[model samples]
Structures are given as C-alpha cells and as structure tokens.
Target: MLFKREFKRNLRSLIIWSIIIAGIILLYLSIFPSMAKEQANMDNLMNAVPSGMQKAFGMDRLSLGTLLGFYGIEIHLMTTLLGSIFAALLASGIVAKEQNEKTAEFLLALPISRQTIIAQKGAAVAANVALFNLVIVAASLIGFQFSSAQTLSYKAFFLLELAVFMMHLTFAAVAFLFSAVARRTRSIVSMSLGLVFIMYFLSVVAGISDKLSWLKYVSPFKYADAAQILTEQSFRPLYAVVMAVVIIGCFFAAYGYYRNKDIVV
Candidate 1:
C-alpha cells in the first residue's frame, strides 16, 4: 500500500521530467541534420579549438557529423545531468518529506516497519528512474530515425544507456542516504545538486589533464562517459561493478540509519 501510494504521489513529477528530457533530446537531435550540413566547417572550427577544450567536451573523441557521435557529444551530457537531477530530487524527498511535514508520527503508527517503508520508497524511485530512461531511449530512437545520418550500432547505444542508468542509480542511492540521515528536508535538493555538479566538474577536469585523471575514479560521470562508450562500443565491466558496489553500500547504509533514527514529531 505504501509503495502504491509513493508511486502515485511521484507519478506526476516523473511524467513531467520524462517529457522535459525527451523534449531536450528531440530538440537537440532535430538540429543534427543542420549541423551535419556544415560538418566540414564545424570540423575545422573544432580542430582549431584548444586541445584541452576538445578533450574536456569530448569533441576530440567523437565526430559531430555522425548521428551516434553527435548524440554522444551533444545530447548525452544534457540527458545525464537532467536524469541525475530527477533521481536526486525524487530520492531526497521520499523519506525526508514525512519528517519535514510532521507526518512521521502518523506513518510510524502504521503496521509497516521502517525498513519496509524505505524499501517501498526506494523501489518507487528506481521505477521512476527506469521509466524515465525508457522514455529517453525511445525518444532517441525516434530522433535518430528522423535525422539524416546513418544509425550506429543499437547494441552500443543500449550499452551507453545502461551505463547511464547505473550512474543514475548511484546518485539516487546517495540521495536516499542523505534523506535517511537528514534532520530537515530543506537543503536536500541543494545538497544533491551540488554533489552531482561537483562530480561532473571533477570528471571534466580529469579529462583535461593526466595529472587529474585519478579524479575519474570518484566521479560517476566518468564511468558513464558517452565518448568512451561510443568509441569502444562497450563499457568497462569493472566500472559497472564499482557502481553496483556503491549503490549497494549507500542503500544498506541508508536502511541502517533510517531504521535506528528517531522520529521527532
């Protein structure tokens, strides 16, 4: 019952985010043909760009003229950012809202344990993230169909999406941990967004110089890098394992914290 309620409560927001992300994908992809028309000029312009800038933006690894390459270089970052925000916002609010709204007492009066509550809420958040990614995948396929460039390997595309989903799951788990431990809900979004952007910046910095390359190990975006996925047509199994470990660790930590937390009315 709690799972159903949480799912219904978040359904509207999930739909809205899905629409916004899909729209962004469509908008950028629609421009691909026009961009491809000036591919030579754009290539020249990009070649003239500083090598560091090219590396930072993935312009050095992908051809902006090709459909898959264009998507990797242009659309991937937007989708990843927006998706992370959506996951963080949802995960951060799921548990903290009850405390912030002074409804935890009423919820605790229910027959369910806190563990069940967290599990249900976490499942809802995961379902929403999965749904959002599914929509984006469909939107991307449609966009590719309409564009003039030839379609790349669908296997590679799906692998890229899987990596992105893993990254989103990690962020959601982190937000869930924050929500479980937070005394107040007011700063949840701010904190989550700050963390996401910080990691993103670190990933970009890591790409710009070898000295900072170690930063990639800490950034989820590095594991989900579309440029690398596009170039290799596959993702590193080790990175995926690391992401899974992070997700499991965060989730267990959240459950442990929330289970022992005092519900102050």
Candidate 2:
C-alpha cells in the first residue's frame, strides 16, 4: 500500500518538484564560485545598492567573499520564496488531491484506519521535503568546495538548512489544516496560497512600517531569517522550536478534522 501510494505521489508533482529543485541546486552550485568571487566587493556593492533594494533585500551586512556568506545574501529571499511555496503547495494539495481527483472513496475503502491513511500521506509529504533539502545540501557542499576558505562548514550549513526545513514543514502543516477543514478543494488551495502570501506581505510591510513592526513576528519568515544564518551561522532556536510545535499541533488538528469530515465523493 505504501509502495503504491508513495510511488504514485513520487511520479506526480512531488518527483517533478524534486527534479526541479535538483536542477536548481546543480545550476546554482555550478556558478556559485564565480558568483562568490564577484560579490567580494562589499564597499562597491553596498554603496551602489539602491536604497529601495537595500530596504527590500536587507543588504546591510552582506559581504561578498565566502561562498556561504555570498550566497546567503544573494539567495536568502530565494530560499524564503521557494521554501514557503513548497509548503503552501504541498499542504494545499495533500488532502485536497484525494477530493479533487475523486479518489477519496477509493482511498478510504482500503483496510487501513483513517489515522493510518493520514499518517501515510503525511510521511509522503515529509519525504518530498527531505529530498528537496538533501539536494540543497549537496549543492551547498559543491559550493563549499570552491570557497576561499577552501573548506566546508558542514554543521553550520546543515543547521541553517534545517531551519529552512522546519519552516517548510510548518507551512505544510498549516496548509494541510486548511485543506482538511475547507469545504472545497480549490478553496483550500486558494486559501493556502493566500495564507502564505499574507504572512510574506506582513513581513515586508513590517520592514517598511515601524507601526507594524509586530507583523514580523506573524510571519514564519521572521522565525527563519536568512541574514541571521549567513552572519551568525544559526537562527533563533526559540522560533524554530515554536514553529515545529505549531506544525505538529496543526497536523494532528488536520487529522482529527478530516477524520470527522463528511465528503460527497
């Protein structure tokens, strides 16, 4: 049962995304060295950076020398975008797919318990996310190989990615909760995307509006600051732990909600 379902998921968007992320990783790593060296000019880069870009990108402490440092600055926003989108998309689809494809009865007819079925699908989502980050790890290692330090900082880098991993899972769990509780599949996906975007916008607005500084805490982006990871080699552990807790809590809530949900399909 696991083989059939997981393989099906693997063949579908999950695997396709894995391949896309792998391609991104390979492509990024290939050019990382040159990019790092090019970014070594801190003064010029900072001085020449537009005020709007600096405000938007948070380019204050970004020195373009070391591979990790350089890429951290350049790719922080990219990571935030990719990580959150994966979470929202995966969560939006996980349960809704069963309904959208009219496979709910086919799946529920299985001998497995409701709990088990939900658990299996959750595992599949986790597996997909793990694969994506593993590719990132491989890419980071390749980048590390060419650093002027000419050495790897495996622990710090992995820990940074681990923070990213947690944020994605949190997003996924929130999305799954929306999927489980919503009345319609398309609505679930729309709401999931809306939720992710709302948080992102809040973060962005918080950056610009001092009156809304509190909005930053409302975003998972606040919890996983790429800039912090770049300079400090770590993120706030409290936020990470809290996000993980929220993810787990939401997952069980989703499971409980879905177990009782009545569907026409």
Candidate 3:
C-alpha cells in the first residue's frame, strides 16, 4: 500500500523528467549529421578550444565526426546530470515531504514500522529510477536509428547506460540518506541539487588539474565518466566497487538513523 502510494505520487514528475532528458538527447543527436558534414571545420574548432576545456567536458578523447563520439561528448553530460537530478529530487523528498506537509504524525500513527516505511519508499525510488532509464535508453536507440553514423555498438551503448544507471543510484542513495535525517523538505531539495552539482564540479576540476586528480575518487560523476567509458568500453572495477560501497553505506545509515529519530506531532 505504501509503495503504491509513493510510486503514484512520484509518477508525474518521473514522466516530466524523462521527456525533458530524452528530448534533449534526441535534439542533440539530430544535429550530429550536420556537425559530421562539417567535420574538418569542427575539428579545427575543437583544436582551437583549450585542452583544459576539452578535458573538462569529456571531449579530449572523442571527436564530433563520429556518432558514438558525438553521443559520448555531447549527450552524455545531459543524460547523467539531469537524470541524477531527477533521482536525487525524487528520493530526497519521499520521506521528508510528509513532515513538511504536517502528515508525519498521521503516518507515524499507522501500524507500519519506520523500517517498513523506508523499505517501501526505497522500492518506489528503485522502480522510478529503473523506469526512467528504460525511457531514456529507448529514446537513445530510436535516435541512433535515424542517425547517419554507422550501426550503433549495442554492447558499448548498454555498458554506458549501465554506468549511467549506477550513477543515478549513487545520487539517489545519498539523497535518501539526507531525507532520512532531515525534516525540512526545502532544505533536502537544496542539498540534493547542491551535492550533485558540487560533485560534478569536482569531476571537471579533477580532469583539468593533475594535482587534484585524486578528487575524481570523491566525485560520483567520475565513476562513469563518458570519455573513459567510451574509450575503454568498460567500467573500472574500482569505480563500481566504490559506488556499491557508498550506496550500501548510505542506505544502511539512513535506516539506522530514521529508525530512532524523534518524530514531532
């Protein structure tokens, strides 16, 4: 019952975000052929851009001439950042919104345990995230069908999507932890956005500065970097492990804290 309610409540926002992200992806892909035609000019334009800028944008190892490269350098940023923002927003508000709306007392009076509540909310989040990825992946494949670039590499594309999904899960876990401990829905929303943007900034800076390259380890964005994924066509085992650890740690911590948190009527 709780899972159904949560999922239904979040369904509208999920659809809106899916459309926005997929639309942007399709729009950018439509421009690929035009850019491909100007390949020489595009290369010249890229050459003129600073190396630091290229690296910051994940364009250092990719080209605008090829479809996959274009998708890697162009669409990957939008998909990851926007999809993560959606995940974070959804997870961050699922719990705290009850208190913000003065419904927490009502919810607490129910027969369900806090553990059950968290589990239901987490399941809703998981379902929503999975659905969002499915929509985006379907949209991407459709876009590829119309592109002039050679046949799409399904293995590499799916691997990239998997990384993207993992990134979304990581951000959602962090936001879920925030929702568990924080009462103000407004604050949780702000923190969720701030966390994602800050981590993204760290990733860009890490790419630009050798001295701070270690910062990549701290940013979730680095775990699924488009350049690295496209080049290697595989996720680094270490990154996967780190993300898994963070996801598990955050969920466990959220459960432990919320189970004992004092609720005000």
Candidate 4:
C-alpha cells in the first residue's frame, strides 16, 4: 500500500520528466543528419577549438561523422545532466516534503515504520528513474532510425544507457539521504542540484588538465563517461562496484538517520 501510494503520488512527475527527456533526445538527434553532411567542416571547426575546451566537452574523444560518435559527443552529457537533475528532484522531495508540509506527524502516528516508508519511497524513485531512462533509450533509438548515419553497436549503446542510469541512481541516493536527514526541506533541491553541478564541473575540469585529473575520482560523471564507453565498448566493473557501494551506503545512512529523527509536526 505504501509503495502504491508513493508511486501514484509521483505518477504525474514521472510522465512529465519522461516527456522532457524524450523530447530533448529527439530534438538533439534530429540535427545529426545536418551535422553529418558537413562532417569535414565540422571536424575542422572542432580541430580549431582549444584543446582544453575539446577535452572539457569530450569533443576530443569522439568523431562527429558517425551516429554513435555524435551521440556520445553531443547528446550524452546533456542526457546525464538532465537525468541527474530529475533524479535529484524526485529524491529530495519524496520524504522531506512530508516533514516540510507538517504531515509527517500524521503519517508517523500510523502503524507504518520509518524503514518501510523509506523503502517504499526509494522504490518509487527507482521506478521513476528507470522509466525516465527507458523512455530516453526508446527515443534515442527512434531518432537513430531517422538519421542516415551507420548503425551503432547495440552493446555500446546499452552500456552507455546503463552508465547513465547508474549515475542518476547515485545522485538520487545522495539526495534521498539529504531528504531523510534534513531539518527543513526548503533547500533540499537546491543543495542536491548544486552538488550535482559541482561534481560535473569537477569532471570537466579534470578532463581539461592532467594536474587536476585526480578530481575525476570524486565525480560520479567521470564514472559514466560516454567517451570511454564508446571507445572501449565496455563498462568498468570497478566503477560499477563503487557506484553500488555509494548507493547502498547512502540509503542505509538515510534509513538510520530517519529512523531516529523526531517529527515536530
């Protein structure tokens, strides 16, 4: 019942986010043909771009001529950015909103346990994230069908999608922890978004200079690198393990904190 309630409560948000992600995928992918037509000129233009900027944007690692390359270079970052925001928004509000709205007391008076509440809300957030990514994947495949570029390796593309989903999961878990422990919900979304952008910038900066490359270790974006996935055609098991640890650790922390938190309402 709790799971169903949470899922239903977030159904509208799920639909809206799915549309936004799918639309972005379609819009960006529609331009691939035009870009591919002027591939030589585009390559030359990219070549003239500063090395730091190229690395920061991953332009240095991908060829613009191929569909998969173009998607990796142009669309992957945007997907990850938007997906992270969506995950954060969902997670930051799920539990904190009840407290902020003074309804947590009413809910707490019921027979339900805090752990069950967290588990149900976590399931809802996970389901929404999964749906959002599934929609994007479908939209991307449809967009690819419309383009004249050569076929992409399904394995590489699926791996990239998995990486993106894992990145979203990481952000969601962090945001969930914040929501569980926060005294007030007013700044949860802002804080989560800020952290995400900070991590993203760290990854970009690390890419621009070898001296700062160590920063990538702290950035979830680095673990989901589309360029590496495209080039290697494989996911990094070590990074996957790290991401899983972070997710599980944050969730457990949230559960522990929330279980002992006092409800003021």
Candidate 5:
C-alpha cells in the first residue's frame, strides 16, 4: 500500500522529467550531424580551448566528430547531472516528508512496522529511478540512430548507460540516508542539489588540478567518467567496488538510524 501510494504520487513528475530529459537528448543529438559536418573547424576550435577546461570537461579525450565521442562528452554530462539531481531530490524527500508534513502520526498509528515503511519507500525510489532510465535508454538509442552515420560501439554505449544508472543509484542511496536522518524536509531539496553539484565540482577540479587529482576518488562522477569509460571500454573494477561500498554503507546506516530515531509528531 505504501509503495503503491508513493509510486503513484511521484508518477506525474516522473513522466514529465523523463520527457524533458529525452527531449534534451534528442535535441542535442540532432545537432551532432551538423557539428560533425564541421569536424575540422570543431577540432581547430577545440584545439584553441584552454587545456584545463578540456581536461575538466573530458573534451581532451573525446572529439566532436564521432558519435560516441560527442555523446560521451556532451550528452553524458547532461544525463548524469540531471539524472543525479532527479534521484537525489526524489530520495531526499521520500522519508522526511512524512514527519515534515505531519503525516507521520497517522502513518505510525497504523499497524505497519517502520521497517516495512522504509522497505516500501526504498522500493518505490528504485522503481522510479529504474523506469526513468528505461526511457533514457530508449531515447538515447533513437537519438543515436537519427544523429549519425557512423556505427556506434554498442559495448561502449551500453557500458556508459550502466554507468549512468549506477551514478543515479549512488546519489539516490546517499540522499536516502540523508532523508532518513533529517528532521525537516525544508532544506532537503537544496541540500541534495548542493551535494550533487559539489561532488560534480570536485570531479571537475580533480581533473583540472594535478595536486588535487586525488579528489576524484571521493567524487561519485569519477567512478564512471565518460572519457575513461569510452577509452577503457569497460568500467573500472576499483571504482565499481568503491561505489558499491558507498551505496551499501549509506543504506545500512540510514536503516540503523531511522529504526531508532525519535520522530517528533
């Protein structure tokens, strides 16, 4: 019942977000054909760009001439940032809103256990994020079909998609932990957005600065960098392990904290 309610409540927003993201994907990809025609000009232009900016944005590794290169550098950025924001916002509000909106009293008055509530809500979050990714995958395929003449590397494409999903899961898990411990939902949205962008900033700064390169290990974005993924054609096992650890640790910590938390009605 709780799972259904939460899923249904967020359904409209999910559809809207999916459409907006898909549209953006199509729109950006549509421009790729024209951009590819100007390949030499694009390369020369990129050559003039500061090396730091190129490194920060992965332009150094990806070219605008090829489909995968363009998608990896351009489309990948929008998808990861937007998808992370969506996941973070959705997860951050799911648990705390019960108390912040004064719904917890009625919810707790029912026979369900807190464990059940958390499980149901977590399921809903997973379902929503998964469904969103489904749309993204389809849209991306269609975009690739219409935007380029070259054959894309299916292995790299799917791997990048997997990375996007994993990135979403990481942010969702962290934001879920935040939701479980937070007292009010008032600042959750801002906090979630700030967290996502801060991690992104760290990733960019890490690439730009030799001294702070280690910061990439701490940023979730580095776990599945588009340039790194495209070049390696596989996910790094070490980064994959780190992301898994973070996800598991955050969920466990959230469950432990919420189970004993004193919710003020």
Candidate 6:
C-alpha cells in the first residue's frame, strides 16, 4: 500500500519531467549538429582553443566533427547533469515525503511487513529510473536519425548512457538512504544534491591529478566516464558490480533502520 501510493505520486511527477526533458533533448539535437558542422571542417578549432578550456572541458581527444566525440565531450554533460538532478529529486522525496505529510504512522498501521515495504519502494524507484532511461535511449535514436555529415552508431552512445544510467541508480540509492534517516525533507533534498555534485567534482579532480587518482573509485562518476565509454566501448564492470552491491546494501540498511524506529504522531 505504501509503495503503491508513493508510485502513484511519483508517476504523476514524472509526467512534468518527461515534458521538460523532451524539450531539452530536442534543443540539444537541434543546435549541436549545426555547430558540429563548422567545427569539423575547421582544422584550427583545436589549435585556437585555449589549453585551460581544453582541460576544463576535457576536449583534448575529441573532435567536434565526430558525433561520438562531440556528444560525449560536449553535449552529454547537460544530459548527465539533468539526469542526476532528476534522480536526486525523486530519491530524496520518496521516503521523506511520508514523514513530511504525517503519513508514516498511518502507513505503519497497515498490515504490510516492513521488508515488503522496502522492497516495493525500491521497485518503485527502480521503475522510475528505467522509464527515464527509456526516454534517453529514445531521444538518442531519434536525434541520430536527423543528423547528416555525421557517421554515428546509436548502439555505442546508448551503451555510454547505460553506464550513466547505472550511476544514476546508485545516486538514487544514496538519496533514498539519506531520506530514510533524515529529520526533514529540505535537508534530505539538499544533501542529496550535494552528494551528487561532490562525487562528480571528486571524479574531475581525480582525472586531473595523479596523486588523487584513487578517489575516482569512491565516486559513481568513475563508472560513467563519457570519454571511456564512447572511445573504448567499455565501462568498468567491476565498478558496476560494486555499485550494485552498494545500492542493495543501502536499501537493506534503510529497511533495518525503518523497522526498528517508532514513528512519531
């Protein structure tokens, strides 16, 4: 019953997200292909770009003319950021809303077992994520259809998005765990956003500094490297396994915490 209600709420919220996100995708596909044309024909684009700009944007190995390179290096950041923001909002709200609405006690009054509650809520979150991923995949395929002078494989980009999708799942887990424990909805939402950006910054720092390279393993961003997924056609399977474990561990831990706690009236 708890999961069903939560899913209903979330599914309604997703409608707005879908409309806004579709607009963003259409915007990206419209402009970038045109800009990419100029960059492709110009050999000096790389040379004229400042070193700081190249390093800051990680444009060293990618060419604007190539759809794979341009998308991974330039266009995908917006998509990635939007995805993280959506996951954070969905996850942070999922558990916290129960307490915020003063519904926790009523929810607990139902005969449903705590474990089933956790399982179903997790399923609800997972379903939400899967739906958005389908959107991204659909948008990518549609975008590819309209591009000319660009030889690109939709399968390759979709695989990169898959790595990103997994990391977003882990992000949702982190946010859901925080929401379960937090005293207030505002704190849960803010901390969830902080966690997402912190991990991304850590990954960027690790990319720049050899001394801090080990920090990359501590972030979900490592498993979703746009360049690596686009160029190598590979993402770290071991890291994906670790992220899956962490996500499961978080939800189970949340269930343990939820079961033992007494809800305040």
lDDT of candidate 1 over 1-265, digit per residue (tens): 9989999999999989989999999999888889998999989988998998788778999999888888988899988988998999989888999978888888899999989988888888888889999999999998987774476889889999999999999999999889988977769878988899998999999989989989989999999988889889999998999999989999999889889998787
lDDT of 5 at 62: 91
Which residue pairs in model 4 clash with each other? Answer: none
Q: Could you estimate the TM-score for every candidate?
A: 0.97, 0.87, 0.96, 0.96, 0.97, 0.90
Candidate 5 residue spans exceeding 4 A from truth: none
- Per-residue C-alpha lDDT of model 4 across residues 41-128, encoded as one tens digit per residue: 9899989999998887778888898898899888898789999999999899889999778888888877988888888888888888
| Each prediction's whole-model lDDT (CA) | 0.90, 0.71, 0.89, 0.89, 0.89, 0.76
Residue 38 local lDDT, model 6: 88
User: What's the lDDT for residue 145 in model 4?
Assistant: 80
Choose the strongest candidate by lDDT. Answer: 1
> Residues 1-265, candidate 5, lDDT per residue (tens digit)?
9999999989998999999999999998888999999999999998999999899888999999999999988888889999999999899999999988899999888799888888788889989999999888999999987765687888988888887888898999999999999877768777888999999999999999989999999998988799989977998888888888887888888888888889999
Stretches off by above 4 angstroms in model 4 are none
List clashing residue pairs in candidate 2: none
Report clashes for each candidate as comma-separated counts. 0, 0, 0, 0, 0, 0
Q: In model 1, what is the error at residue 252, expressed in angstroms?
A: 1.3
Report the Cα RMSD per candidate: 1.1, 2.5, 1.2, 1.2, 1.2, 2.1
lDDT of 3 by residue, 120-214 (tens): 88889989999999988998888886674466567888888888998999999999999999999899999999999999999999989989999
Candidate 5, residue 116: lDDT = 85
lDDT of each residue in 1-265, candidate 2, tens digit only: 7535764765566656666665665566567666556654664767697654554455665555555555666665566667678768876777777878888888888888878877777777777767666766675566455444545465667777888888788888888788777757788878888888887887777666668878767888766665566567677778887898888999899889778888767
